[model samples]
Target: MLYRYGSLIHRRARLVLVIAVLLIAGAAVAGAGVFGRLQGGGFDDPGSESSKAQRLIDERFGGRANLVLLAHATGGSVDAPDAAAAGRDLAAALQREPGVRDVVSYWSAGVPDLRSADGADAIVLAHVDGDATQRRERAGQLIERYAADGPALHVRAGGETAVNLDVNGQVARSLAIAEAIAVPLTLLLLILVFGSVVSALLPLAIGGIAIAGTFAELTALGAVTDVSVFAINLTTALGLGLGIDYALLMVTRFREELGEDRPVAEALATTVATAGRTILFAAGTVATALTALLVFPLYFLRSFAYAGIGVVVIAALGALVVAPALLAVLGRRVNAWPVGRRRASRSAGTAFWARLAGAVMRRPALAALPVVLGLLVVASPLRHVAFGTPDEGVLRPGSAGRQVADRLATGFPSNQNASVDIVLTGPVDRDRLAAYAQQLSTLDDAALVTSSAGTFGHGTRAGEGNPALSRPTGERLTVASRLTAKSDAAQRLVRSIRSAPAPAEAYVGGVDAALIDTTHAIGARLPLGIAIVVLATFVLLFLFTGSVIQPLRALVLNVLGLSAIMGALVWIFQDGHLASWLRFTPRPMDTAMTVLMFVIVFGLSMDYEVFIIGRIAELHGQGMPTDEAVRTGLGRTGRIVSAAAALLAVSFFAFGTGTVSFLQMFGIGCGLAIVVDATLIRGVLVPAILRGLGRLNWYSPAPLRRLHATVALREA
Candidate 1:
């Protein structure tokens, strides 16, 4: 099948090139519309209990207050004449805005909790009326208008909407910065490895097609679904990296075949059947791993699955179809303008790999133990790893939204700005409601609780009922807690509130409640997601190797390498090592980011796994002895793997310079994983395990062996 495709492409190389150019140009133009269609936040599980509560609240009440305007007095207390006038004006201005509602402030309501302890800062709470995307848009406008220092009062926006805007903006900036740094460095390295300026340019062409194509896909997907803007980052990095990886494999094989003086068509066909087949298997493994993300409820994670699977398929197609068409057209000009003797350097590097493989295979178990132990030690920190949702804290301290959050956390006592909003539906008995509200207010972390019955503090009725808390169908209560939002303590508060006896159909929906539900939703679905990844990988790899044992070995080594990387992330991001240098807060690992890292790293590990094992399997198929095949295969593929992994690492590690902590962890972890796997795991552990397995490395059950014989594409 591959040979026929390559031959057809070769015969029609010029027509193929012309057609591909037109299609990709169209894709580029369509892809330019993608940004306008993308959204800001998708981290919440919309069907969880918190979501249900939110739905009920939006239906029963006006809407929950999700935007906070922090009004600060530059010279005096908020109650002073000038500051009071400014606070009232701020509230009135917000109330008059088109999409702003439920406006309440310290000056108008005299809510003690809305005033800071020092009396210099007061908060105006309002509900931005719209869907998540629209709310962010409305909030952005309000922030620009009001969230600035003034002669009388200073105001800043903070809350769900503001945080979403900041995160999205940071991601946009991170992508630009990462591309700005990675692209030039990658080109320089590609030139050094390929030993010619012409050869280096080919990968960029492949990458451009992959990225442009995936961007078009995202644009179409975004038009109908909730796609996160963050997915754009994955699309850019993976598209370019995969482009280089597939190009290096294909070009190297083509060059080798051409050296045998084969006709251009014959050489191209051989390259497709060989390197092209490997690219197919590699793309399958990557897509299979990413498909598991669809099981998660969060669109934030699912968006990556869309972008990742699209990039893999598009990049692989470019590598197979468009790339071959280009190569066929280029013919011997593909090797034009050489900078140095590329073949001689590869030959020298191959010899070094052969010696290293021989030394390891000679004493497989003995040489493997120390390396295995060292990796286990690197993975040890995962034992105590913690996880949290990304918030304003993920942004740099200087970010506007983050600064507002910082002030809210430290300056305020207890306010609805950071509270568990519990709505009671169906029927509300006033006396029972008062008792329930009192029960919540008496909890250790509950600083105050207010309902239609009255406001309570420490189990005592401290104020009259607020009309906003009452409704015809039921009553709503706001629990102003002492625990920080999205914290372990805050999550505990949610559990306590849920566990507490209720007077009616109580629905808890707030930042803390949402966090608890999001965590639970992910945990409940994780096992199935993991099962899909493991089972699918095992089957695909078995198909590739025709051996059950080889897949098992690959899976083990990949997991080990990924564990070491995850543990390193825990030590650095979660445990606060290099926090100052990375310029991120030391907190729990972002659960979504951790899951993303694992899947992506796992997929990429399979990428290198396919490259090395494809060569080893081909040599073995030619009746080479096990020891000879292991040494020769490592010798042949080592330089390619090293160079490819280095280029890919450059693409990822540039994100380490980002101000967003989660992206920093993601970039650094993935880049480090690639480097470590290409060197230690691929170079040392693989050959040692192969030597230990001997002929068993290719062993399969009789049924599978017969099946393999029927459909094996082992060589070009």
Candidate 2:
């Protein structure tokens, strides 16, 4: 089947090239506006109780204020006549902005929560009304207008909306920085690997085309759904990494076939038949693994699935379709501009990989023991792993949103923005609601609670005249508690309030409650996502290798490699070991990022495994002994896998230069995993295990073998 497709593509190489160029041009045009349409955050599960409560609060009571302008009295106290006048003027000016609503300030509202603890500063709170994109756009404009120093007061913009805007800006900047570093570094490394300028440039060209196509797909996806801006990072990294991976494999195979003096058509056919099949299975594994993320309710994760799957599909097409056309057209000219040394003759059987594989096969147990033990030792830090959601802390230090968050954390009496909102449905009993609010305020974690009766502090009613605290619309009344979002204290407080008695059916909502519910949602569905990825991978590998054990082995090794990577992430990012060097404040690893890394790394590990083991299986089918097949296959494919892994690692490592902690974690973790997988797992352990397994590596039940045979992936 691959040969037939290759023939058809080669026969119409010029036409295929024209079509590929035109498609890329169209994709570039369609994708030009994607960044502006992407969302900054989608970490909440809309179906959860917290989400419902939030919806009720928005529809019934006024929606939450997501923008805060901090006003600092530079010359005197904010209550001083001049500073107070400036604060009021700024508040009134913000209220006039098109998208700004629910504006409140200490000078206008006389609310103590709006006043800073020291009295020298005050907050102007407002709601940025619109969808995610609109809110961010407005927040940007507001920051430009309001975040400036005046004679009496210095104003700075912040809050959830401001944080979103900052995050969007950072993502865009990081994408540019990562691409800048990745492109040139990747080209240099590819030149070193291929030792030919033409060969090196082909993979980058394919990668560029794949990225353009992926951006177009993401733009379309963003219009209909809440696609996260972070997905662009994934799209760029995966597009380049996988595009180069597939191209490298195909190009290397084509070069080898040509070295054997085969005609251009025959070499292209042979290359596609072997490497093309592997690329198909590899792409399938990656797409299936990423598809498991769809089980997550958070679009933050699901967005990656969308981007990853799209890039994998596009990268594969570039390799199988566009790359083959290019190779057929270039022929031996692909090797022009050779660098350093002429391409070495692999038939000499003196390659370093063959010798290394032979040594491992001769002492399988000795070779494998240290590699396994070393991986376990490196993975030990996972025992202390903690999970949390990203917040303003994810922003770089000294950023506008980070500055506001730091000030809020230190200067405010309590974070009203992080307050947990308890919604009561069904009946309005003022006394019962007041009693519930009192109970909430009495909890050690709760600083205060507000309800229709009044605001209560530590179970005592502080005041009762605030109209915003009273619900005049319907049976629903909101009781808000002062608790930090995504904190352990806040999580405990949410649970306590949910369990506390109330006059009606109560649902808790706020940043804290949303995070708690999101955590649960992930835990609830994680097992199913893992099951889908594992089962699908098992089936795919079974069809590819006609063996059950090989798939299981692949799973085990991939897990070990990924576990070590996760452990390193926890040690460096979560444990704060490299906080200064990485330039990120340490916190728990983002739960969604952890899951994303696992699925993505597992699938990519399988990708390299398929390439290595498929060749081994082919050689074994050609009457070579198991040990010999392992050595020969490793010798032939080892350099390709190493070069591909290096290119992929470079792509991810570029993200390490990013400012966001989560993106840094992703960049460093995946880059380390690729390096470790290619070296320790693929180089030493896999060869040793194959030697130990011997004939058992191909063992399968008769019924399963028949099923596998029916669907077996042919290797030329």
Candidate 3:
């Protein structure tokens, strides 16, 4: 099938080139709007209990106060006449803004909690009305309008919405920086690998086409659904990385076939029949692994899945269709300006890779044990893994939102925005609500609890007769206790509130509650996500290799490699070992980012696995002994796999240069996993394990064998 497609493309090369040009042009135009269309945040699960509570609060209490403007007095306490007057004016102006609501400040409400501990700063808190995206937009404008240094006071915008805006901006800058570094470095490495400037440029061209198509597709997807701005980083990295990978394989095979003195069309056909088939299988595996993220409810995870699948499909098409047409046109000139002697067709049982494979085959168990143990030792830090949601701290240290968060954490008694909201439905009276508030105040971690009846601290009423604590409709009352997001104390406080008796049906909603709920939602669906990935991978690999065992082995090896990568992320990011070097604050790794890395790394590991094993399987089918097949296959494909993995690793590492911790985690984690998989696992463990299994590596139950043959890809 690929041979026929390649033949048709070769025969119609000019037409294909013209169509490619047209598609690229259209894609570039359509994709230009992608950044503007994407959303800034998607960390919450809409159907979770916390979400329901948040909705009720918004409906009854005018939404959660998710925006904060901190006003710092220039010389004295905020009560100084000049600072007080400026703060009051700023608060009043904010209240008049179209989307701002419930603006509260020390000057407006005389609430002590709104004042900083030192009395030199005060907070104006308000809710930005709209969905997440709209709220971020409004917050951006408000920051521009209000965040400034006046003679009396200095004001800075900080809150969930503001943090999201900062995060989105940093990600954009990081993407630009990553591309600027990666593209040229990738070109240099490609030239070194292919030893021809002409050959080196093809992959970048294919990558550009794939990236253009991916952005255009993402823009279109954003029109119908929520797509996280974070997906853009993945699209850029994978589109270029995988595009180069597939194109390198095809170009290398074409060059080899041409080296054998085959006619251009025939060489192209043979190249497509072999390397093209591998690309299809590799793309399928990658897409399947990413598609597993669809089981997750968060748009953050789902967005990557969408972007990943789109890039894989587009990259594959570019390599299969556009790359071949380019290759057909280039012909012998593909190797023009070669830097070194061009590699001839690989000979069996002779090359350095073959010799290494033989040495490992001679001592399979001895060779395998240390690599496995070494990887396990590296992965040991996962035992201490801690999960947390990303916040303003995920941004760089001096970023506006992060600076605000740092100040708030240090100056305020507690984070009001991170407060736990206790919603009481079917409440009877003030006395009952007071009793509930008293119970909440008794918890060791609860700083204060506010209700309609009074404000309680340490189980005592600190104040009374606060009407603003209750909804005007009078059927609901809100009890708020300040807490930190994702801290153990906050999590414990949430549990206490839920288990404590209340005057009415109680629901807990706040940053802490939302964090707990989001974690649970991901955990609940995790098994299913793993199942989908595993089952899909098994089926796909069985069809590709006609052996169930090889697929199972692939999964095992991938898990080992992924374990080390996850452990390294925890050790470096979470444990703060590399915090100074990486320039990120020490915090628990984001749960969603961790899961994303797992699925993506698994898919990419399978990508290299298929390329190498498929070659070995083909050699075995041609009657080579198992050892000879392994050696010959590794000899033939080892350079290509290493080159592809290096290119991909460089792309991911470039993204690691990003200031955001989320991007850094992805960039470093994926890059390390690719390099480790390509060298340690693929080079050492795979050959050793297969050599130990010998002919059994190809064994399957008779019934399954027949089933596999029916689905297995056949060479022309």
Off by over 4 Å in 3: 340-350, 426-428, 472-483
Candidate 2 displacement at residue 610 in angstroms = 0.9
lDDT of 1 by residue, 125-185 (tens): 8889887678878888989998988888988888778888888778888889999999999
TM-scores for candidates 1 onward, in order: 0.98, 0.97, 0.97
Global CA lDDT computed for model 1: 0.88
- The prediction achieving the highest TM-score against the true structure is 1
**Sort order, TM-score high to low:** 1, 2, 3
Task: Give one digit per residue, the lDDT tens place, for model 3 in 1-716.
Answer: 88898899899999999988998999999999999889887788989878888888888888878888989899788999989999999999999999889888889888788888999899999999997678877988999999999999999988888988888888898999999999999999898888789999999999998899999999999999999999999999999999999999999889889988999999999999999999999999999999989999999999999999999999999999999999999988999887764454233212767788888999999999999999999999999898888888798878878877777776787777667887776545777878878888898778778778888888888886467658744333334445556788888888888899877777788778888988998999999999999999999998888887999999999999999999888899999898898898889989999999999999999999988998999899898999999998998788888889999999999977888998899999999999999989999999999988877898889999888778777766
Report the C-alpha displacement of residue 524, candidate 2, in angstroms. Answer: 0.5
- Candidate 2 lDDT over 341-408, as tens digits, reads 64553333228788889999899999999999998988999998889988899987889888887787
Q: Candidate 3 overall Cα lDDT vs. reference?
A: 0.88
Would you list the clashing residue pairs of candidate 1?
Answer: none
Q: What is the Cα-based lDDT of residue 396 in candidate 3?
A: 85
Worst 10 residues of 3 by lDDT: 341-350
